[model samples]
Target: MSQFLSAIIPNEKYYEKSAFEQENQKVFQESWYYIGLTSSLAEKNDFITTDIGGKSVVIQNIKGVIKAFHNVCTHRFNKIKTERAGNGSLTCPYHGWSYNQDGIPFGIPLKKEFQGLDKESLQTLCLPEFKVDFCGKFVFVNVSNSEVSLEEFLGESAIKLKEISIMIGRKIEYHEIPNKANWKIVVENTLEGYHITNVHPTTFFKQGFTLKSEVDFEVQGQHTNMTLHLAESHKDDKKRAKFHKLLANRPFQPEGFFHQLVFPNLSIGSLFGITVYIGSIKSVSPDESVFAYELYETNLGEGELLSDAISEVVKFSSIEFTRTTLAEDKEICENVQKGMEQSNATKGVLNSSEIRIWEFQKSYMNLINK
Candidate 1:
């Protein structure tokens, strides 16, 4: 674990189109992708459409079972649905071809034009489905047909993630910000807290957050969790006691903030018992990506205006802090992207605090090279 060693991946890998294409095929397409929360499709026939490595996919809840399929029409290869989420059977807009919840084509206009095409034969035209799974209320889809289950892929991180989701109770806010940087940069920035004192001095570090020592580092399989503790000197005994009393009845009692990074693209930051921030990074191209944030809060009881107001204020402030931090990180990433795209740019070294970044880069290289 030499601190002065160079980055695992070369600078060209960050902005090269060829490297991006390889990653899309090997990493993004092969690995499981986090979709929206399960609550997003609460009813039968409810479906959500999204893209994986530029390939469209649709996930639907049919008769209590969740299923995923390629969102392309079998007739003319047209995208059947483009909406984010909806309820009803999938019908191709190109023609009147209708598909059942299971992705089987059930109806087609001009029946006489296709004399040999009946429901039985039309089964061949069914949409191609991918592997779909859930962890607590969160949904995930893997485009690859590999036998490895999402649970296995997630390993120990699965249970921790589910626990956090359950503690948060319900999702209260969701937003996605398009980023003009590579996905790896965003993920790397998240894996370590070394930048907090410098990059987030005003927002996070100024609030008494201190990164856990290396001995406290916890890494399981492809996931890593770093606990951020509040400085003892910054603790207010009276205020702390009041907050604990206020949230005593809640399901999850917060101790300190915990930041977890699931290899490749997911990052979760939980602040005491106040709020949980789940972020997903999706690559759009060699130099473009999307950073999505899902904020959740614990159940504080029903119709309590004061409690609700407190929660609202916390959520609003959290969102603002996250936005400010992201803006700062994004600027750095964009600049890095620019430097990496240049011919003379060389690889940089990682400090000991950035060990997680090194681990992530190694995992990524292993996958893409495999």
Candidate 2:
């Protein structure tokens, strides 16, 4: 292996320890996790069923607002709505009991028999209120005793993202793919541009980016921000000047690059005309992971240009690159799991390059272990 590859220090402490995995009920399911875009369920009665931290949740648009509730039927404990998403109050297939968008029982099979039953108790049975809320086009959820709001959870990072959203019009579409790897694998792949020149050589140097040296890291609570000068400093001024002049309207980064990894499951990055939001959705079991992702750019033209752009990016990320890159990543993560089982190393090294990943692991451990 090359010296740089050998020198790449990786933090495997959290992977080796099962504390986070075993007690994820508190860290994951109970705490807020991102579900889906609010735009996806804009109409009243529109709902989608997805596994959140191993639990089944049905997020819906009721009346004029969005709400989420456990997919379980109150009486028989069966999934009330099985479709990924649709428009209607969730009615139990087992019993006729129905829940409104807020997760309150609007109707029951036998209204007479349960006469004295405090129907309002259903309020206590809300789908689950996340301690944290949302920022612009994206939403964040805290499933634990998150004593913070959406603004607090994101810190200053949310402002940057909201600024990016100003360029996008209407609703954005999400493209997600499943991978057989631990969710952490995906996050590590995104944090730094080190792999860009090689792993995605075609898309990196050949396509649009003119990346610069060294990454800048920032940490707030469990979230992190990383910056890079895409247009290198030593390089000639003409190209760099043109690059900056084009994107000058957007919030400027230290250099020409901006990226953030907001703890455990999200990686958000920005580009001249676009922003890439990547996150993972693991099954109830941690073995399988879903790469939930989307790319947004300013809606420049109407008609076919906008649709074409969305289609091309989605096809590239979710279909083409997803299979090749994600598969390689998944195989490595699985092998890492096997190696972790065999090795009994108590300590791991974190070099300058890996310090941020180390910090991320520490943040995850701190949240779950607490």
Candidate 3:
């Protein structure tokens, strides 16, 4: 790291309530958010509701096209959909107001109560919509009307992610964890390997992963990618043979594990032949954030019994390992949040190993200050 880049970011960026509000408005609301895989809403009317910044959003598939809208009912202002995901027309649980998959108001109860109202007049009552786009099978939504396309925002990271998404086939598991920490804390924790030896010693370090003396860091716009090379000992013929056998039937094989940070709050850890874990941070407040994860595995399609058995064992083991590693990160992030709240210091120093953290802080400061 350059001497000029190794400085402490202000503590207020992590724990200050006012600063959190500003970030929500300026950073998250204006940026594109990765929702999930396009296959998540494969059938018509399949919908998923999520929150961006503090605003509620409902995304659904309608006649093969994906659409997003404010989750609130236009009539009563009640949330249109409360469940996390399901397959059905969006309906307001409050008063029976219903919307089509396109978010167009199609049914409003009590026809006699609103005598003059009809479908033609109701067309103008469509739910407020957001912009939606995709990169491979992954879907992203932007709340702002900014002209920047998702591809532009993603840049080089998009190319890498698209390759990984294709290899992973489709999403197999989804999980959400609510952490008692600022969203920044969770994101910063992921952008560097400085904590792996200490924080994930048994899981990552034991597996021969380390922060190399000469780290290869690439920054494209707000996105960053860091490549981790496993120790040569871990790449011996025996283990290499086993890995190749396990992934023999898979369509795309990854060259190596990659840790990528998609600016603002998406962290991706892609382990070749193991799993692809995408952790998306959703800030609930200054001291709370929800981390949503979608885990994907390589598509094996149909195979012989022996091959299927080996694949299942590998998949199960990979999922378990990932779950344990994520739990470790979650615990550390929560503790960091508590420390920031009680500390009197204004900032903390960064080391060379944390160059990505510095990059993230700089990116964040640029956006919030803008």
Provide TM-scores for the models: 0.91, 0.75, 0.91
* Candidate 2 clash pair list: 30-143, 31-142, 31-143, 31-144, 32-141, 32-142, 32-143, 45-88, 47-85, 69-127
Candidate no. 2 TM-score: 0.75
Candidate 3 C-alpha lDDT tens digits along 1-370: 3553544468877878888888878898999988877777999889888888788999998777799999999887999889888988778888899887667877777866986787787877889999999988778999997999998999888987777666665455788888999988888888777777787877777777766423467888899988666666565558656766766766545445678888888888876545678778888888888888887766653422224665576568767777788789899999999998889888777876678888888888888888
lDDT of 2 by residue, 120-153 (tens): 6766554543332557656555555556566766
Candidate 1 local lDDT, 278-365, one digit each (tens): 8888888889998888887766544122366667767777778778888888888888788778758467788877777877888888
Residue 215's C-alpha lDDT in candidate 1?
21
How far out, in Å, is residue 209 in model 2? 6.7
Candidate 1: where are CA atoms >4 Å away? 210-215, 237-241, 300-306, 343-345
Candidate 1 to native Cα RMSD, angstroms: 2.6
Residue 216 Cα positional deviation in candidate 1, in Å, after optimal superposition: 3.6
